[model samples]
Target: MDLANYKNAYLTFALSIQQTRVVSMAAGGALESFPKNLPRAHKDYVVDASAKMSEKLKPVMKGVSGSSFEMEFDLDDGNPYLLPLVGILFTHVAGLGGSPNVDYGGLLKAQEVVMLFAHLEAFLADSIRVICLKEPRVLKKNKKMQWDTILECGSWEGVIDKMVDEYVFEAGWGSIKDKIRNMRSAYGLEIGVSDTVLNALDAAEQLRNVLVHNGGRVSREYLERTGRNDVRVGDMVPLDGSYIEKLSATVTVLGGDVFSAIAVKFFGARPDELRLVFKGAGTVLE
Candidate 1:
């Protein structure tokens, strides 16, 4: 892969997430004053519409009394006025009846961390696939396939693609150490990341797993994988903005490291040349 491709992809992901965070913060601030910011006419319309909707729903509510089904509203109720009314209701609901003690910012940050690692995993798998495509001999026949499946591919390129997908799927994207070892063993390619970067990546993977599978609570597996002793299992992992920002920066560095290694090893690119290319593309390599 070209260094610029990797740089652009990662930068785009990071920038898009940062913009989302900014927009979310702005929306939260706007929502605080959403009711007050409406015109008098709009306010009156919202009040009248809400009362009318409540009356309309009263019959349905009585019909479903003591049942498990919750009330649902169609936001696109064909009335344009309902949109602003929905926004007003959302403000109160999200604020938990005006107290507003919910940690929405933390929740967003946690989700961002999960998404960042997911992107990294996808990029890593793509890198492996690209390398196997470029050098087909590097793909070991470790998977068994039926003759029908092989024939179904129809072409050599299709077969190779199937083999690549199988390899990536079986190899999985769990342990960073196992990933590095697999890359070196299967493709004779060394990832060449520092211990610090490897540890960060490992910790990131662990955090992603906990956030996804354990409701962001620390697990024994997380501690074992990340080598973290700071928090015990069952504790909620703190995903503050600064911590997520630092993790994002580390992930970006890890991306560059992996991309540079792959480019040099498989694409016949020199490190110095790749650095210059990335710099020309506005990514400073250290």
Candidate 2:
């Protein structure tokens, strides 16, 4: 079931949060200053220094988020899930590198969070297949496994492995949303926390598509997809560190709860992974 790997993914992501905080504080300073009272210097030299710092910070945040993201998505190599959550941290890093206006880099980082969420959804979809789809004991003339079962589970065990793999590769499934809905419905799985998580992901997707495919320029497609009609085309997304942290926390809780619910439902009990200290998520040293 690779359940251990899934739990570890969240742990890895949670620990990465500390790295983000550390890197960000180092870049922006530790004092709590309100923007309203902060210095409003418009000098070119001051701006240059911010950008220069960003360049230095970008790599550290990227490395942290990227490794965590990989922990989830790198299924075959067992590295980690597709980590995504260091962008808002990087804007300042990019600033330190001397390009004071680091919003462009921030936009790019926000876009990465979107991609990471999408990949995580796919990972969950694959995991659900193990619980929702089961192989029939013997071949009957009238009985054939459902399409999703074949597609989701390609030869985890016996003779059908090769056949199932070919079918999954060839067939088409809709979005990750479609797959999640179907799996839950088929198995009557309880996903009390998924709705909130999905909302965050949906928002991420809307922003992601724009930042990734449209040069950070808002468009009609983005407005329609996100249902954010207050702005017009070419408007850059407003992403910040706090918002990114909110998204990360939402996804983290969702994964933990959803995994627990599905595991208990499918196996009639939680796996031994319940012993793993899930405590490390969102914790950091001062």
Candidate 3:
């Protein structure tokens, strides 16, 4: 197989790695803080002005009820701070004090990570394009010219060019599912990114779309799209730092795995060029 032909796609795969790394590094500090730096309610919940004098009672100095709110975050791991942070923000927003419920910094960081993956998905499209072309199942050019479609001056080579061009270029080149399907059909390549990664990508797409289109309120459509049984309509989806970190890491690793898999299948070994640049290895090929 001629490696030079696929060099452009390989470069794109490498560039995707660099871009994701930069984003991940920039987000590293933000994730380390996780819930510690995230918003937290005062240990003693404050009461409204009407309840100020009554609130001073020994039994109820600040809060009226201990279990006024409850929240659960189903993530890759159980974080002690996750529920507390959510409670604090929810209480603040629900009118415990005034206006400090929303963690703007954390939200922005999450959005950035989501954007990073969105861009990565596009880059995956480019990688898939090259992988399809290099597939052994792909047929050579056909120069069959139609009765009147072919011009008198055009050679049968032109027909071959058209066939190759249309076949090569007409693969559904946008959607992630489309790219994955093409790889599978052409050569049975399976892009085995984890369920966590897929779920995160799904969440990111929903969050991004909601924020951009509906001002960040989790709509029924968002709920339907995410399919997270726990999340309800009208719930606010916080862009948690930890969630973003997991997503970024998963996608980056998955991209490398995909690159390595493609190289191994096509070349019967890890390509020297891929190793020199992408250093991609350990793609579970079947």
Q: Write the per-residue lDDT of candidate 2 for residues 1-286, one digit (tens) a residue.
A: 4555555554565455445545444434321232223244423333444344445555556675335322112224322211111243344344544432334336445644564565456446445444423432222235356767766665556335544443343322554445556556755767655554465566676676676788778988888777887678888777666666555555555556556665566655545655443322452111
Model 1 residue runs over 4 Å out of place are 1-75, 78-100, 224-232, 271-273, 276-286
**Could you tell me how far off, in angstroms, the CA of residue 34 lies in candidate 3 after the best superposition?**
19
Q: Per-residue lDDT of 213-273 in model 1, one digit per residue for the tens?
A: 9999999988887787889999999875666666666665556566667777877776565
> Predicted candidate 2: what Cα RMSD to the true structure?
14.0
Q: Model 3 compared with the native: what TM-score?
A: 0.51
Pairs that collide in candidate 1 are none
Full-model lDDT for every candidate:
0.65, 0.51, 0.54
Candidate 3 residues 51-107, lDDT tens each?
332333334324465535333344334344444454665566466767444554655
Model 3 lowest lDDT segment of ten: 42-51
lDDT for residue 286 in candidate 2, whole number 0-100: 16
Which residue pairs in candidate 3 have backbone atoms (N, alpha carbon, C) closer than 3 angstroms, thus clashing? none
